[model samples]
Target: MSTVMVRPLLHLIPTVLIIAALGLSGCSTSKPLPRQTAPPAAVQTDPPAKSHPRTPAPKITGKPKTTISAAKQSVLVSERNRASCYRLQPGKTSTRMIKKHIPAKKAATAAHLAKKDATATTAKPMTTVTRMVTTTSRCQPQSLIYARCRTGIDTCKLGDTSPVQWFACAKNNSATTFEPVAGSVLVLDRNARRGMPTGHPVYVEEVLPSTDNIWQLRISHTNYDRKCHLDQDATVLFNSTEMTASFMTGPWAPWAKDLKALGFIVR
Candidate 1:
């Protein structure tokens, strides 16, 4: 065997130092360990929800109408039409239900029956109405009115409210009515002032007057609008009679009487 050589103490001292470092490695403070984090807990979540909602309506329609009922009809106790119980609404241009006219056949039958029923009837001529009455100055008779009369007649008295305008009677001067005749008293209607004063009444003793100078028959009129009695059997009148008797009367009589004495007649 070869002879083993031993290094010096200095070299042996370095070997021992290296062994000592390996032995002291457990005391290091810079080493890291494995992380121990808790596991993630069970995840909890909510389910989804809902929103809003909806609904619907109803119906109607058409035109209005007009009608007449039984309650609207008239019930007359004394009806002219015994057969027809009710009348409909009349047309604007038509007439209401009225008295029925006789048919032509019915009229002919009535005429025939009337002819058989006819008796001997007396026929007489219609004469003019003649009358006389006292009157005052308030009765001014208008002679200018065109009165209908015969050729020789002097006065016209037709007070009917027709085509013929007549003079009113003495008593009816203020009334709306009158008579038709010569010599009949005529009155001015309370409202009859056609050409004369109203409320006037006068006498028409003569329809025609006698002419002057010849004393013959002629168409002349003399109206006495006013009259005053002079005395018994004497009158102070305006016209006619060819006399104006004033037996010691007043001045008013003389004025009228003198005119009578002048041959001016009073109607």
Candidate 2:
């Protein structure tokens, strides 16, 4: 009886040992559970860009200022006046008078043809050919003056008188003075050598600043060249003491030395 019991107990002990060994092997071979960490901290990022406000440009209020020199101003004024004067047209009567005064062209002499004579040395007469040349009048000084100075002069009183006759009309109707002034009529005595057969009358456009005591005048006239052409802004020098004016620069400057200056006619 003791043997049988002891054998059974031994068999039971072996079975229990095998089960424990199998449990230990399974635990060692199997992988351990991974440690849990707080979810990766949310990645920090820069905030979205903000829109910027636009700045308004300043507004301009008025016209820009400009600086002009005195000489320039004078020139601008003279030019403006001259342009205004040019816009005026000569009256029909004045135009007709100027055209009437235009000199007629002389007839051309007959052409003489000489032929050889076998019998004697004499010239043979042949039919003559005649040619005539004609010229048209352009403009006259008085007409231009009347038109330009209509504002300052009485054209009706002046009528169609030539430049030479303007002195008396100016003296009677206008104030004659030695002091040269703008918008005045300058009267010069006749000088055949200077080609001023009908004296000369010019309109004073401006009285320039003078370095010397003498007055420097800017004048506008026509027909001084006898071509019936207009000239403007001609420089002239006036001597109050001698009461004379000389052309400083112009077509007449070469021939006109110191012509007698009657005076300036101001209305």
Candidate 3:
């Protein structure tokens, strides 16, 4: 070993020691490196966007067009058909003229009815009933032979219950006197010598108003024609005074000019 080699070696030792110390100091003073992370796994995110609801398109229908065409065609076809039937030749008659001249079909039913009416005409043809008339007699008095008195008593049980004498009926039944009622009886007690013995009775069939207060009474009776037979219904005037009178005068007495009309027996 040489002295020179020893000295060189010592110097190399010092340099190495200083370099190591410097390296250690740099390591302690220096900041640590930041840890790197994978970019936050690409967070799938989206920005808010406006939303719109879908609207259905309007539907178009072919109904109206099809119907209109069909109806128009039908009307045109009908007019064409009618024109064929109604057309008239230049020299011939029109359909209207032919129809006017055409004879009506035979009416067997009408002919039969006419024949029946003719056969019935032999036995007093039935008169046309202008107003309704009941076939049944309306009178049902409690105790009286006179038709008028009987009718008064029966028709109105509450009224005319008293058995008034035929002559005094007007005086006795004044309270019950009213307008003529259909099917009520009228008594004729005018004169005994005039062929109206005791009293003649007539039935009222209908009452027709002539004015506000005046009325016409249709009446029927037996022997009105002096032939001792039932007479057809005849109309006679009933004045306002007679409406309230106990007994009104009737025009259809056989022997007397005026017949007494007993008050209607109606409550």
Task: Estimate candidate 2's alpha-carbon lDDT, on a 0 to 1 scale.
Answer: 0.63
Worst 10 residues of 2 by lDDT: 54-63
Model 2: how far residue 91 lies from native, Å: 16
lDDT accuracy of residue 139 in candidate 3: 26
TM-score each candidate.
0.14, 0.50, 0.31
In order of lDDT, best first, we have: 2, 3, 1
lDDT of 2 by residue, 136-235 (tens): 5444344345434433556435566765566666667666777887767787887777767667778787897655657898888765654456678789
For each of the candidates, the C-alpha root-mean-square deviation to the true structure, in angstroms, is: 39.6, 21.0, 33.1
Ten-residue segment with the worst summed lDDT in candidate 3?
50-59
* Model 3 spans with C-alpha error above 4 angstroms: 1-175, 210-212, 225-227, 242-262
Off by over 4 Å in 2: 1-81, 84-125, 128-134, 137-151, 155-158, 209-213
- Residue 211's lDDT in candidate 1: 39
lDDT of 1 by residue, 1-267 (tens): 233444466569888998888777744532432222222222222221221111111111111111222211211211222123121222233234333433233233455447765555523223343344433223323232211121112333444232113333212344222221222323333333222233323323323333342121112122222322111112222323432222123332444322222221112
Q: What are the per-residue Cα lDDT tens digits for candidate 3 across 10-118?
A: 8799899999999999886663432233333333332222222222222235667778787556434433442232211122222321112333354435555667446
lDDT of 2 at 182: 72
lDDT of each: 0.29, 0.63, 0.46
